[model samples]
Target: GNLNERKFLSTLVKENEVIVDMFAGIGYFSLPIAKHSKPKIIYSIELNLESFKFLTENIKINRLDNIIIPINGDSKTEVIKLSKSGVRAQLSFLVLY
Candidate 1:
């Protein structure tokens, strides 16, 4: 991951904004945003179970469990489920690399 990109992305997050990370990947982007951006909540979705596990652990280690919700499943499917459940995000990050 690029440190500059992560820092830039974090700065874009406004206070009380809701964020959805399509490929959380152990909370790479999610962690920074949660820790510095002051978002109200972040739904961090990861398809890989191993990555998801680390994502949860990272959230705990960062003491951001209250701000980041780690989900283990396909991002698209999980996002649809979240929408149906009335979870709306002000910003959604989908990184492809």
Candidate 2:
């Protein structure tokens, strides 16, 4: 995603809102959103182990561990599990492609 788009998206996030990024590769969108937006929590799901690793590291590096929960697995399956577990988000970013 473009930097401007990320910034714009961040602004759309309301304080204390819960967000879910279905394809949070290396926290591309998650990072900025977690940083600029005061969301209560962000469930970032990534399938690639390598990308997931970077996502976790980025969360720590950005000091957003509390707000961003990095999950390593297929987003489709993970999302189903999350829903069953009663994890709800006010906004969900499902960027395909």
Candidate 3:
């Protein structure tokens, strides 16, 4: 069985706070954050095209289009670009699987 970290992470999020998820595979963690935390915005970057596609679809399926912005690229580069573009997040987390 997979360890469910949803409750812990969800509790860490604050309303109107911004979040950056470096490896949001299939929205596994992002979905819970967006849906449960109700953050102002979440920048979810997934490098793998297949995973990115699922991330995008899951956002719609969960009705989190406005909250989660999916970026299909390497998380490192995307995060650099986001910073250059002035997108800031209150919290950032990286997941490796």
Candidate 4:
């Protein structure tokens, strides 16, 4: 069931308990992780409004709005929010292109 998923993410984030999808493409990966792994938090970032819209819709479709945090902007900049909480989100897994 989680065979493929565990392989893909485990490689990059091997030890990263917390993961971040730098480029949340329609929530292809973010939604899955949030749905399966059920991590503490998933920050889905998308610069394009169209992409962001799709991501948001996907999150709703999967009912993961509570688990996945949709950031409608560049992940590089919006990542600051994770720190606003005083360093609670020390992400170890980062998904990029």
Candidate 5:
């Protein structure tokens, strides 16, 4: 299991913001990002279909149906829209675990 990094990251999350999980990996961090943070839009990208499916199911299982958006694609290509949309809006925090 991994430690919760988003608890601190959420301090930087704001309304009208975009977040990109450069490597979403089963939504380990993205799920919490939606639950404990502001209601900003999130874009989670996963390369593995199995993991992406679980990631979507995790969101549903957690009942976080409205906030975290899961995408099954490469982060490098998939995140362009999110980045252009404004994920880099604020680099206020960077918590890694």
Candidate 6:
């Protein structure tokens, strides 16, 4: 379907890279990216409660708990906290989808 872009982007992620996925909807792109790329850490921020719930469930189902961190709230505020959390790794990408 619409996985071409996601598939391509996943190839760009390197080891120990950090990612901040804004507007992550039910781990659609994030899951594929995480599964394929295996970044050091990914902060997936979702605003919709239902979607956020699914996001967490998906992460768990995929056993990516140590890699993908699910944030249930507005990306606008959560991004700031993540940026200030002393995550010293270089950001590999900011997935806006």
Poorest lDDT segment (10 consecutive residues) of candidate 5? 88-97
Best by TM-score: 1
List of clashing residue pairs for candidate 4: none
Ordered by TM-score, highest first, the candidates read 1, 2, 3, 6, 5, 4
- State each model's CA lDDT, in order: 0.93, 0.92, 0.88, 0.69, 0.71, 0.82
Error of 4 at 34 (Å): 0.9
Whole-model lDDT for model 6 versus the true structure?
A: 0.82
Candidate 1 RMSD to the correct structure: 0.8
Worst 10 residues of 3 by lDDT: 1-10
Give the residue spans of candidate 4 off by over 4 A.
1-7, 10-17, 87-97
Q: Give the TM-score comparing model 5 with the true structure, all chains together.
A: 0.75
Tens digits of lDDT, candidate 4, 1-97 = 4568645763443233556677776877777667556476777778889999999999999888887888888777777776675535545345433
Return the top candidate by lDDT. 1
What is the C-alpha lDDT profile of model 5 across 67-92, one tens digit per residue?
87888887677767666765663432
lDDT of 2 at 79: 88
lDDT of 1 by residue, 1-97 (tens): 6999999999999999999999899999999999879999999999999999999999999999999999999998999999999988999998877
Question: What tens-digit string does per-residue lDDT give for candidate 6 at 2-96?
Answer: 79987987887887788888888798777988899868888888999999999999999999999999989887888778779875545534454
Candidate 5, residue 55: Cα displacement in angstroms equals 0.2
Provide the global lDDT of candidate 4 against the true structure.
Answer: 0.69
Candidate 5: stretches off by over 4 Å: 81-97
lDDT of 2: 0.92
TM-score of each: 0.96, 0.94, 0.92, 0.72, 0.75, 0.86
The clash numbers for all candidates, in the given order, read 0, 0, 0, 0, 0, 0
